[model samples]
Target: MMRFIKPFIMPAVALAAWGTALPASAQDKGPIRIGVPTAIQLQIGRDTQTGVRMAIDEINAKGGVLGRKLEMVVADETENPEQGIAAIKKLTADEKVDVMIGGYTSGVTLAQLPHIARSKTIYMEVGAASPAITQRVKSDYDNYKYIFRSFPINAAHQARGLVDFISGMLKDEMKIQNIAIVGENAKWVQDLVPILKKGATEAGANVKLSEFFDTSTSDFSPLLAKVKDSGAQYLIVILSHASSDIFVKQWYDARFPIPIGGIDVKGQDQDFFSRVGGKAISETVGNFAVRAPLTAKTLPFWDAFVKAAGTAPVYTGVGGYDAVHIYAEAVERAKSLEPDAVIKELEKTDYTGVAGKMVFDETHDVKAGPGFVNLLFAQWQADGKREVVWPKQIATGKMIPPPWMQVQ
Candidate 1:
């Protein structure tokens, strides 16, 4: 039988064993706890953990935050909302973490918000891109003031970026006409694909196919064939929880002629090329982790992360890294670890992070545009290196046609 679970129910056993928060002065004594709730098995989650640790390592080496060493604790949320709630409860109620840093799937983040509000522990969201997550802050600031996203802008802004990419890069520069939109059926993508379709049509292109696939979708052959039969000259695939690597491999194996781009979370991994056995040759993803030195800290962090994590970091990894530093800065400036004080300081954030300058808007989401947190498209070039190809200013290389298309 199908069962319906309560919106924010705590597991009875865990609730019974929850730990008490440390009193005022005692809270500042030991290490400042930073808890991470993520799908630990995924690349985004793995990088989130690494990014948080990188910041803690840097701060500790520099004599620590408020003279107290920083520490990270992890609980796997596994892309499940129930698991997400459990993870947040464990972090705020059991671990009593001073700050929480990590998120990937949007549904999971939405599910975890209420628990965060109740605990009043500051959460620096590193991954999820739903605009609704920040909407709560604008709608109910008193309760959701503890929430803030430090990376990758939001889905609405991201859709606008996609429109810009399709308009400038695909349409004007490449003379592309027909385009198709493929995205996961998740809340975030479902909300974004409409705006993208409208904007793409208004920007001048025949909207060939707009399809949403299930997250559990493994066989993409029929979908790819349909997209091909539709005569789409360019394809934009948006994926978060779905397995992007599999789709990329299938597309390559079929020698798909369409030039593909847009957000692919797994495709942002530094090792994705080899992970897909070089099947990601022409795959382009909306990425911020490209090594173009968007800021002075960008290149150094990239090199450091490579050495530390034994691979290149993804956009979410950079998000986590930025969140920790932003939180630490707020703590130092406010001269206290209290949630309210830190939140006020966070609202005034203007840190030039690995991607771009980080600042919260009226909704507490990062501001997006040129000179701020702009989205850049990065493609796997023929030489097996990823390079930015859009918006002109920071592009390392131009977007090239796929081998199959070039042959034609």
Candidate 2:
């Protein structure tokens, strides 16, 4: 009963050339353009692009929106704010895409918002995690209602789950109290650290050291040395792909003997163990969106992705797949491509995507709870396996320290 469209990717250069071919009015016809950030420099960009393409394929096979095929125009954001703004401008002003989705970095997504608001094109966030995205809309709904996030929980909302998991699972269950908080020095992590600190304190956990480093920082020896000296039971991290593997490798090579956990995006990817290699991130735990076999939608799509890409869907992939379907459903419900009409339909969405029930709040951010798209905490086993370990209802296993930690 499912129909899928053939997948295609239009490079930025070709997209620019195509956009320039249109006259000033740029009459809307042909394919429905969906702009995406392919940021080949970042794996998450490529991961998300796969999901967008998959969703578009399914929609086009279903006859697409208003009889027009869904197509993707990609530009590289490279996890940079300036590049993100430039790519968005090209997609909106040049390519004239009807919808835009899949921004991985919080800073990059925020940088593109002002232009998106002015352009009035519907934008669905796939990976940006800043709480401010929807908050900006709340503060100025008249100008920013055009923006919506399908993936990536607002950092503020996720903090509660992260904290509670740490308190209940790590602290109480595992008897971990002294914790060192380390995160990337970015807007999203900065906003979360304070909340994490407060929650940890409230739960009777001691914060040994709270530190942040630039995303580009590769040498974590100094940071590990600090954690080692502090004698913390756990090192809570907030990081992405750029430095996640590097940190893990460094930690393992150094044999710091402390358990690592929290929000490590790259750590949750199916390829993480192979990519990082040889139990480097063993016993490492983090929260992620959708892991296969969690919900009905998860396994089907997960199998498809692994079949096509030789790997399972990452969080961004989950987000992109959901965003495309959400957009398609909106267009169908409104029966029009008019931005306002589509926005109205999007605002009323209650669809259950690959992750979970996606119902938007006043600010257009996914509501966080057990019944909704709740965060799943997972731990990497010693044999390079990952298992969900928290939120008992969906958990696949319990948290266990690596052999190295057990001896300590």
Candidate 3:
């Protein structure tokens, strides 16, 4: 028999509260506090907050984990790196949270890494794609083992799928070959570009020009002109924080003839096409979910999120949902609140979340590829509809070039 899930209401006094904590029994009477530090102003934060709260509400409704109710305390880690570090401190030190979930923007996430290690709080990083985050764990496990990136597989890992998709799909369909890789000057993109270059070159694709730009560079006209002049058949972008709306609109309006593809983080939002006034047509971007039933839990989570948030969740929103459940399962397996015990259980997790089987490798980063998590490239079709167009088996539609470069 299935249990009916209820929609969660935001608590009135969440930040000002503390769970009861005293000398407790084998099963602590106090609630397990889950601290969330993310950029509340951005879609990533708002949706992630909803996902975490939804998971917590579900567990509590089912009598909670190990007889201890779960609660949440949130600290807004605005886009600023300083604010992000302070939010980490607040959650770890002042709030005394049992486990931490949430992070966005690589720079801010990188700044909070040391603070998280110092606090020794098991942080399930639901966002942030910098490979450096988990490389620290591989480089020095004793201090960094407390950290784990639960979602959005690292940038270096993402490159493999993107390269294959760009070189294989476009070439096979439209006979397009040359690629000009442009990325936002951010840590995760920096990590991704090199891997992308290597993979594309090995796939017999030409790299016409590879350049990066600052996140604040609003005018993409000059760069668009450069890509146009470079004679590249396709434009592979690695933008996360840069003005993608402006860049994409410019790309579409300019009719550069080069189809855009790669990891445009902003384009992953469910309402991106509508939000951008439908300029993202024919733009294929890397994604985590497409409201498809990848697993049994996938559609339930998606429907619940829509019912609660009044909109479809962005990528990190799903990450936040998976992180909470993963945390609770780890704690239950260990039967203890201690970080070390839970860490052991988390390492052995084979849980099938919305995306796929989330199994962590030795580096504590989620595994990517066959039978694990595969990077899905989704295209924004006509009228704001998105269709997964890669990995053929699960692809909803085939990749289409912009009207300027129509396939024969």
Over the stretch 1-408, how does candidate 1's per-residue lDDT look in tens digits? 111111221121011111233355654598989998888888788888888777777766565667677888898888899999999999998999999999888999999999999999998888898889989999999999999988878888889999999999888988888999999999889779888999999999889999999999999999999999999998899997788888998899888878788999888887788888888887888986678778877878787777677788887789998888888888888777889889899999988888888889988899988789877898897757987888777788878777777722
Residue lDDT tens for model 3, 1-408: 112235564332112112332234734468899998988877888888888888888777666777778888889888899999999899988999999999998889888889999999999988899988888899989999998999988887899988778666867656778889999998888889999999988887889999999899988989888988999988888887888899888888888788888889888887789888888999998888767868777777788788888888888888998888888888877878889999999999887887888999998999888877778888999898888888677889877778776674
The list of candidate 3 runs beyond 4 A from truth reads 1-28
- Report, for all candidates in order, the number of backbone clashes: 0, 1, 0
For model 1, the local distance difference test gives: 0.83
Poorest stretch of ten by lDDT in candidate 1: 9-18
Q: Which stretches of candidate 1 lie over 4 Å from their true place?
A: 1-28
Residue 285, model 1, lDDT: 89
Of the candidates numbered 2 and 3, which has the greater lDDT value?
3
Order of candidate numbers by TM-score, starting with the best:
3, 1, 2
Model 2 residue 8 lDDT score: 38
